[model samples]
Target chain A: MRVLGIDPGLTRCGVGVVDGAVGRTLTLVAAGAVRTPADEELPARLLGVEQGIEQWLDDYRPDAVAVERVFAQHNVRTVMGTAQAGAIAVVCAARRGLPVALHTPSEVKAAITGSGRADKAQVGAMVARILRLDGPPRPADAADAVALAICHLWRGSAQAHLARARQEFARRIETARQAHGL
Target chain B: MRVLGIDPGLTRCGVGVVDGAVGRTLTLVAAGAVRTPADEELPARLLGVEQGIEQWLDDYRPDAVAVERVFAQHNVRTVMGTAQAGAIAVVCAARRGLPVALHTPSEVKAAITGSGRADKAQVGAMVARILRLDGPPRPADAADAVALAICHLWRGSAQAHLARARQEFARRIETARQAHGL
Candidate 1:
């Protein structure tokens, strides 16, 4: 399945697109950033971000979307911006009936670099090597977006398996309960 | 002018519409809440909010929108949700080229009541009186939404005046500079 990954930010929202499924060769589709002027008011800036994301969605038509889950542990101001920006991406994807998954920063790191504590450079290096690029995607935000896409391709498949297994287990339990009339 | 007020939340988003100017008697057009199930995922929850806000905007066609500004000082998790919910409202209004203003909680309270530190009950009572209602609007969220609408009718006017004054001052300074060839 094709996936669009978003690294949400108010000033610069990083975006990347990739095509792949479990045990499949990943194809790099796009990498870019949606930038809004810092001096603009919040409402206008958010609208700009929305338009940029919509353009990408219309251009790529990805089957699923992956967004970096925002955490509140950092600077309060920055955290709020991240959450707001992330909301725009989430709402856009959900509006289209697309499957949207949010992966935490550590999860993205570990999925790509095999270590949750991997620094930016290590993660960037891994993304480059995995994508078969000469170097990491230009601009750190683009690199992060690519990493997030790659992470989702790997982890989303695992999650799908786990969900299916849970459903099967629940069905078996219900069947046994009905058989005993309990 | 008609104004729509939004008190953003994840589970229940308060919404109200009022028609009035700063010195005019306020007319309540609508008061209600847009509720999303708590069990819903974040993306779907946000989409729910976006749809709710869009419905209001389409139904009322308000000249401006007033949304409660979110702060991050208390409860980081809750703050993120509030910010996210508020972003949906902001984006919806901005998409239509509508003027969107954000008022802090204290500002809304102070504009409706005599004190910024007014309790919820006091604010509710004042909102009922100012709007000449028999009682406050139903549900705390609905009451707050109405209060925010009234607050915007008052405070938003003052802000517009200040903005016009600043613009006029800048224009005069620019004219003087052009005359002096500076």
Candidate 2:
């Protein structure tokens, strides 16, 4: 399945699309950054980001979306913006009825570089190597987005399968219990 | 002018609409909470918030929107959710070409009550008095939303006027410069 990954930020949001599934060779479809002027008003800036993501979603039409899950940052302002941007992406995907997955930064790095502690450059190099490109995607944000897509393609599918299986198991048990009239 | 205030939260988003100006007696047109199940997935929860805010905007058609600005919290998860929910409100208003204002919690409290450090109960009491209600709005979140609306009506109008004055000044300056032919 095709996956679109988003590294959400107010000033510079990263988006990448990849075609692949677990145990399959992933192919890069698109990668870029959505930029909004820092000097612009917050609402306008967010609108720009929202419009850009919508454009990407409309163009790429990915099967699933993966967004970076924001955690606390020492800089609360930055963290707030990041979380807001990520949340918009989530809403966008949900509106389209697409399943959305959130991957932590460490999880993305580990999935792409075999180490959760991998540095930016290391992860970038690995992304390039795995995608069989001449070099890493331009701009660190784009590379990070690509890494997020790769991580979700590699790891998220299994998690989704597990969740579905658990739900199905519960449903079967409930049916059996009802049959027993409990 | 009519103002819609939003106190955004993942589980319980508060929304209120008021009609008044800074020097006028504000009337509460509507006040309530948009609740999402805590057990829902993050994307679904955010979707609920987005839709709720959109519905409020559509129903009230307020001239402006005011959202409670989220700050750093000891609970990072809660803060993230709040920020995301607030962002959606901003986006919804911006999409409608409505001006949006953000007031910090302390700012809202100070505007409604006499003190920035006022407790929720005090703020609630003050909101009820200012709105001339028999009692404070039910559910602390709803009161907070009312507080946000009152705060914006109290302060945002002046800011808007100032901005308009500045724009008019710039326009006159530009016209004079053009008349000088250089």
Candidate 3:
């Protein structure tokens, strides 16, 4: 399945699409950033972000979307903008009826580099190697987005399968209980 | 002018519509909360917020919207959710082409109670008094939302006039400069 990962921000939002499936090699379909001017009003900037993500979703048509979940940070202003951007991305995907996943920074690092504590360089190196790129993706945000897509592709499939299994198991248990009339 | 104030949150998004202009008695047209269960997924919750805000906009048809500006907090998760909700409210207003304003907590408090550090009880009390209600609005979120609307109605008109004057002044200056060929 193809996955679109978004590293959401107001001034710059990173987007990367990856074509992959469970236990298969992943390929980079596209990588870029959506940017709004710092001087613009908040509402306009937000609308720009929403429109940008919607366009990307329409163009790439990824099976799923992965967004970097906002976490508490020392910089409240930055975190608020990131969270806003991330939320807009999720809304855009949901409006299109596409499945969305949120991956924390550590989670993306762990999935991409096998270490929750991996540094940015390590994650970038791993993403480059996995995607078979000669050099790391330009603009750290874009690389981070690629890493997010790769992480989602690698981890989300397993999680979805597990969820399905659990649901099926619950269904069978309910059916058995009904048959027994207990 | 009519103002729709939003107290943005993930679980309970408070909305209040107040009708009045500057130097006039404000009336609370509607006050309530748009609720989303905490048990729901993030995307679904975000969608709920979007839909809720859209419904309010459609129902009230307010001339302007005021959202509480989220600040960095000790609790990062709560702040993130609040910021996301606030952003969605802004987007909803912008989509409807209504002017949007963001009032900080301190600003709202000061506008309502004459003190930036006024307690919630003081703010709620003031809201009841301003709206000429016998008792405080139910749910602190709803009261706070009313305060947001009141604040915007009192402060936003002056700001809007100033903005328009500035725009007109700039236009005149450009015209004069062009005429002078300097």
Candidate 4:
């Protein structure tokens, strides 16, 4: 399965795509960020974000999208910007009929580092080690996104397996119905 | 000056335009909403939002945009949707080189009514009375957007006055420098 993970921000959004199978090795396909000028008008910034996401979607074509869920904060402006970025990810994933999985920061950290309170450096190190890369990803945001993708890959396999089981059960039911002429 | 107020949402965004001058009465120029299919992919929905905002911008040509600032909630999905909608509004205003102002729900309520804790219905009623409209604006969201625009108009005028003062001061300095051959 191919998974695309995203860390959304108003100024910069980091995205990573990973391809792999359950109980098997995973590969990093693509990674980058969409950045907008801080001084630019909000509309232009959003357009830059949209265009960047579109390009990534077209290029990667991941089967699923994993996005970090927005967490509540005391700062209204920061919360607002993060929320907007999160929405862009949802729109991008929803438009393509790609199933989206949301992962909280804690969940991703626990999945990757076996600790819910793992710091950025720890999570980045874990991601780099797991992916068998030379070094940790730059711009911590990007590394977090990659870790989110890894978490999804680990969790998503269970979902894929369940779906396959359901399909097989439906097929068996249909075969039995045919035999009974019902 | 003409001010456009926008209430951003995932499925629908309400827009209202008001025209007025400082120390003069404000008039509602136009009001409507842009709706998108919830089931469509996120990108398509975003495109719909962009087109919708573009149409309104072209039709109204407002001097400024006033958008409601999104607040973070416990529901990550809902928060994400609101954020995306907010970004679209920002992008719409920026593309036309129009200044964009953001107002919190409480701020808009306080501007329309005496209390910041006023509910949507009370705020809608106040908006209708303030705008001298025939009736309460349909779709409460649309009325809230109008209120937000009114708030911006009031606040923007104050900001403009300060900006103008600064510009005049700078111009006087330049004139003095030229006269002194400095």
Candidate 5:
């Protein structure tokens, strides 16, 4: 399965796609940043972000999307812009009927580095190791997005497996009940 | 001129429209709310908001859009949703080249009731008086949106007049300069 991850921001929205399945080595499909000019008015900049996200969706067509869930613990104005950018990403993915997931920054880092408190450099090193890259993706932001995609692939596949197992168990119960003619 | 006002929220987005030019009696064009199910996932709900805002824009075709400027002082989670919703409206307006303005709750209150700290009832009352309504729009949320529209009309018209005057002055200066061959 291919997954797209977004580390959303107004000035630079990081986007990365990885092709992978459960317990499989992931392949980097694409990685880049979508940008809006700082001088542009807020509404126009927001529109630009939306257009960029749509372009990425058209180009990659990932089976699922993972976005960094925004939190309110940071700089107020910047966080607001980040949240808005994240929303645009979410809306774009949902419009196309693609599954969307959100992972906190720490969650993504932990997923990649086995520690929630891992710093950027550590997380980047681990991500490089996981994907067998000579180094992490050029920019730190894109690397973060790539890590988020890896996190989703790992978690989503596990959940899908559990769901399928549950379905199979229910089917067996129904079949046994019918065989008993009760 | 017509103005569309949006009070952004994830659960119940209030929308209102008003029609009037500078120094004229304003008419209440419409007032209502757009809703998204609370149980829906964040991405799906955000898409619903975008669709709702698009529908309002299509129906009203207002010259401008006025959305409540979201602040980070409120409940953290709710504020994030509000900010996201506000961004969607701003993007929709910008996409259509409609002038988009953000009015803070306090600023809207001050414009309508002569005091920034005026209570909701006071703002609603002033809105009803200005628009000649028996009472504020049925829901409090819609009333807030109507007030925002009125606030924008008053402010936007003054700005437009100033801009027009400046342009006309520049034209006269150019004409005088040409006559003098300067």
Candidate 6:
């Protein structure tokens, strides 16, 4: 399955695409960011974000989307920006009929660097090593996007397994109920 | 001066332009909304918002922009949409070199209805009365935008007065210090 991961922001958004089956190796397809001029009006900037996402969707066409969950903090401005970015990601995925999943920062870090508290530099270094890149992803947002994608790839398989188990259990229970003639 | 008031949202954004001066009457110049398909990709919707705002800016060329300030809320999804809308408005104003002011919901309601706790219908009715319109502004969001603009006009003048007072006070203090040689 091809999965697209996004780190959303009003001024700058980082995106990464990966392709692989559950419990198997995944390959990076493409990655980039959509940035708008800080001086531009809100509507124009929103258009830039829309145009950028459309371009990526058409080019990559990933099967699923993964985004980072917004965390509450003291900085109202920062929180607001993060929330906007998250909404944009959700709307984009919903429009495309792609299932979207949200992962926490710590979950992404743990999946990538074997530690939930791993710093950005550490996560970036690990991503570089795993993806076997020449250097770290520029602009921490981009690296984080990649890490988020990897986390989904790992956790998604486990989730799928649990879902299958639940289905099997339900089927057995139904069979037992029928046998009891109740 | 012409002031454009914007009520930002994910699916639809309401925009209203009004003509006013420091002491002159305010008149509605134009009002409308920019909407996007909910099923489209987030990026595409953002592009629509950008283009819509650009078209409005080109057509109206308002003197200033007034937008609602987003406060923290419990619903993550709702807050996300609000933040995105707010960011787009800010970016739009900044791009055109138009001064932008933000007002809280309570402030706008108080300005229009003489009470901050006024409901949407109440606020809309008051806005229509204040502007002497034949009917209320349809699609509550549009009326809200107009009310927000009115609030800015009133509060903006008050702010100007306060600023002048501060300047005069500072000047008096400087003159006194100089005369006393302290």
Highest-DockQ candidate: 1
Alpha-carbon error at B29 in model 1, in Å?
1.6
Query: Which model, 4 or 6, shows the larger DockQ?
Result: 4
Give the per-residue lDDT of model 4 (tens digit) for B1-182. 99999998768788899998878998988887888899975666776886788899999999999998776753656665667777877866876778888898888888779789999879888888878987767676688778889989877777888999999999999999999999
Per-residue alpha-carbon lDDT of model 5 for A13-120, expressed as tens digits?
989999998777889999889999999888988999899999989998899999999999889889999998998889889999999999999889888888999999
Candidate 5 residue spans exceeding 4 A from truth: A164-182, B164-182
> Between candidates 3 and 6, which one is better according to lDDT?
3
- Tens-digit per-residue lDDT, B18-127, candidate 1: 99985678898999998899999998899889999999999999998999999999788788888999999999999999999899889999998869999999998998
Report the Cα lDDT for candidate 6.
0.79
Fnat for candidate 6 (0 to 1): 0.27
Clashing pairs in 1: none
lDDT for each residue of candidate 3 in A15-96, tens digit (9 for 90 to 100): 9999998778899999989999999999999999998998998899999999998878647778888989999999999888
Q: Considering only chain A, what is the TM-score of each predicted structure?
A: 0.87, 0.86, 0.86, 0.86, 0.88, 0.86
Candidate 6 lDDT tens digits, A1-182? 88888887778888888777765677778777888788975556655776677788889998888988877653666677676666666656766778888888889998988899999889989888877787667677777887788788888987899999999999999999999985
| Model 4, span A1-182: residue lDDT tens | 89889998878898898898988988888777888888975667776887788888899898988988776653666766666777767667776778887899999999999999999888988889899998777677788888889999997887888999999999999999999999
I-RMSD for candidate 4 = 4.2
lDDT of 5 by residue, B67-129 (tens): 999889888889998998888888889989999999999999989998999999999899999
The order by descending DockQ is 1, 5, 3, 2, 4, 6
Q: Comparing 5 and 6 by lDDT, which wins?
A: 5
Listed models, DockQ each: 0.75, 0.60, 0.63, 0.41, 0.73, 0.19
Off by over 4 Å in 3: A160-182, B158-182
Off by over 4 Å in 1: A160-182, B159-182
lDDT of 3 by residue, B1-182 (tens): 88999999999998999999756788999999999999999899999999999999889999989999887864777888898888889998987788998999999999999999999999989999999998768777889898999999888777878898999999999999999996
